[model samples]
Target: MDYLLAILIIVYVALMILVGYIAWKHTSNSEDYLVAGRQSNSYIMALSYGATFISTAAIVGFGGLAGTNGLGILWLVFLNIAVGIFIAFVIFGKPTRKMGQYLNALTFPEFLSKRFNSKFIQYFSGLLIFLTMPIYAASVLIGAARFVETTINIDFNLAILILAIIIGFYVIFGGIKGVMYTDALQGTIMFLGMLILLISIYSMLGGVTHAHELLSSMAPLFPESAKVTGATGWTTFPTTGSPFWWNLVSSIILGVGIGAIAQPQLAVRFMTVKSNKELNRAVLVGGIFIFVTTFTAYVVGALSNVYFYQTTGQIAIQAAGGNVDKIIPTFINSAMPKWFTYIFLLTLLSAAMSTISTQFHVQGSSIAHDVYCAIKNRSSLRITRIGILIAIIIAVVLAYILPGNIVATGTSIFFGICAVAFLPVYLCALFWKRTTKLGAIAGIVSGTVSSLFCLLFTYKKVAAGLGICKFLTGKAVLFSGMPWPYVDPMVIALPIAFIFTIGVSLLTKNSKEEEIAIEKMFKAEEGA
Candidate 1:
């Protein structure tokens, strides 16, 4: 079994390397490296987009949450399909693509900086991304590394190092083209692997109806701490207005759902394709892809409770030693066929690599292409490669040290920060002509500061454990005023940022050149 699994992994990795080599040979310029020369097809773009967005966070982090919280996680699935894929593509994709071409924008920070003609916007945004994105990237690394360690029975730190180096090799050499090519292949694996796992879980439990029925009947086993947080059961939504509900609705769902709009990696994909039409076509495929992968993972995660209860006389969380993040991996190891366990490990690897590669690429672009290049007034491909390596090293170290359940914590931090810091400015830059450079700067500063403050003073995770917060406050959280232990900054910072942007913009005036650029952006044709 070990030999067979090793063979499968070697073959899969070899394919990835071959694809990277091909992409490296074709990467003759920065454009090809950054945006795949803006010539990707709808299929490749769609799969790549979905794969990058739905990483181990979806499969492992949120899947574990479903094991504890129940079917209510489906609300996130609905939001992903509706807002993430459909609205993102139809409402934001076209204008972004057209304007990206109009302004010669390559990265998200570059797009904003060029849009409003603000060097501060460009530099600050790039610096923020470079600084904060490692948390999210590290989370993805931790998720995949956890599975790799458990499945291969190796030292956890060594597993993380191995995974990071492999990912960095391809991303540093292949650029965006290699990343997307691998993403397409990885996305297919994730979709198929998830489908099979879901089917097998249901078959083991009789069927979907029986499986859910059994799960629903186990509500009495719900945890007491979960009860205080408003958890009704694994089969129902937490009590509205309860701490759990707030954590679920405010932190997880709203943080991630609305946050998707501002994700630097995903947003960059809009500039990768040739036309808005390609983005439009991608919506359908992406929607289906997200649904299949996320839905199956959530459903199977919750149902795994029944399987564990029947087999081990314990629930999913208990069987996995009380770590929610370990629930899915444990189930795969103990409950599934040996052959399928190897397959699912690849799927998890696919999820991790697809997402991490994008993170590394975007981080590299943030520092090298956007910050350094803009300041130096030249694009050095070598600098970007070096940036990629630096980003990988930082993320790998963080992955080794991050707390348990790093997936959820890391994902929430980055998503919440992006929603608060970037979404308002990005949205206004794309749609609101009156959005001045000052307004954008004000929004960015207020958003980032407000979110970080709230995270340090209000959220328990960062407030209590983050040494800086504890040193300054002498407590986990400075203020105990929050109704819940966990409330994402988006609930507060996002609104503040949005209102501040509008108010500041209304009070300020755009320069003549800025006005002309905004007008040109609004009226520009594709490839103009």
Candidate 2:
């Protein structure tokens, strides 16, 4: 089995290299590297968007959360389809595409900077993405590597390096074209593999109804760690207003769901397509893709409890040795056929590769295109490639250092920060013509500072994990309250950002030059 898996992995790597080589041949300039030359079809756009949006973090990290938290985590599935896909495509996609084309913007930060006519906004947003995105990228790396470590019994550190090297090869050379072309292929593999895993799980546990009934009956066995925070059971929602509920709702569901709109990597996908027509066509594909993938992950994660209890008389978390990140991987390896484990490994690889490649690309472009190029007034593909290399190295190091069972928490932290820092400014850029450069800058700064403060001082899980709060305040968290510790930073910071953005914009008038730029940005809308 080891020899077979090795041969299969080699074949997969060779195929990816071929795809990357093809993309490399076509990528002659920065535009092609950054936005796929704005020539992507609906199928490619939708699949790439879906593939990049749903990573191993969703499958392994949040899936394990489902195993621990139960079916309540399924709220994220509805939001993934409704907000992440439908609203993002229908509401945000058209305007972003139009304005990006109008400005000839190659990146998300550039789009906003051009809209607001602020080099500061561009460099600051770029810097934020470059500095913070490694946390999210590292989570994806850990998710894939954890599965590899569990499935093949390989050293965890070695698996992380191997996955990073494979993904870095294509992204550093092939760029967005390579990322998207390969994403389409990988997305399809992920979809099929998940579909099979879903079916096999249901079939293994008798049928859908019986399997669900079994899970529901086993609710009494909810973990004590979760119960101490007011968990009622696995099948039902946590006690309302409980720490568990706040963590589930604010940090996990809303953080990732609403935050998806402002992610630089995913937002950049809107500019890959040519028109609203392609985005419109993509909505259905993207929606179904997200639904199938996320729904399966959550449901299977929840049902794993039943399988584990029946086989080993232990709950999902216990069977996986108390690591939430290991629930799905352990379940798959222990319960499923050996052949399916191979397929699932490919699924995880595709998930991790598609996401991390895009992440590194965005991070690289943030530095080389948005920050460095904006400062130097020049574009260098060599510098962008180098930036990508540096970003990959940082993420790899983070993967090595981050603690266990951190996949879901790390994902939410980055997503929440992006929401607080970028979402207000992003929305204002697209919709509100009255927004000034000062207002946008104010929003970004306030949102970023407040969010970091909350993470370091207020949010118990994060502050305690980092130990910075304890070092300074002599407490796990500065706040000694129920919801305060559990409340996500986005909850506190996003509203503050919106108020600053609107109030400041209303108070300070746009300059003559800024007014002209704003008008140009909204000219299409005004004409319509």
- Candidate topping lDDT: 2
Q: Candidate 1 lDDT, tens digit per residue, 66-165?
A: 8888888888899888988998888888788888888888899999888888888889999999999999999888888888877888788988888888
TM-score of each: 0.98, 0.98
lDDT of each: 0.88, 0.92
Off by over 4 Å in 2: 1-3, 525-528
- Give the top-scoring candidate (TM-score): 2
The C-alpha local distance difference test score for the whole of candidate 1 amounts to 0.88
Instruction: Rate residue 421 of model 2 by lDDT.
Output: 91
Model 2 is weakest, by summed lDDT over 10 consecutive residues, at 519-528
Q: Give the lDDT of residue 345 in candidate 1.
A: 96
Residue 44 of model 2, lDDT score: 94
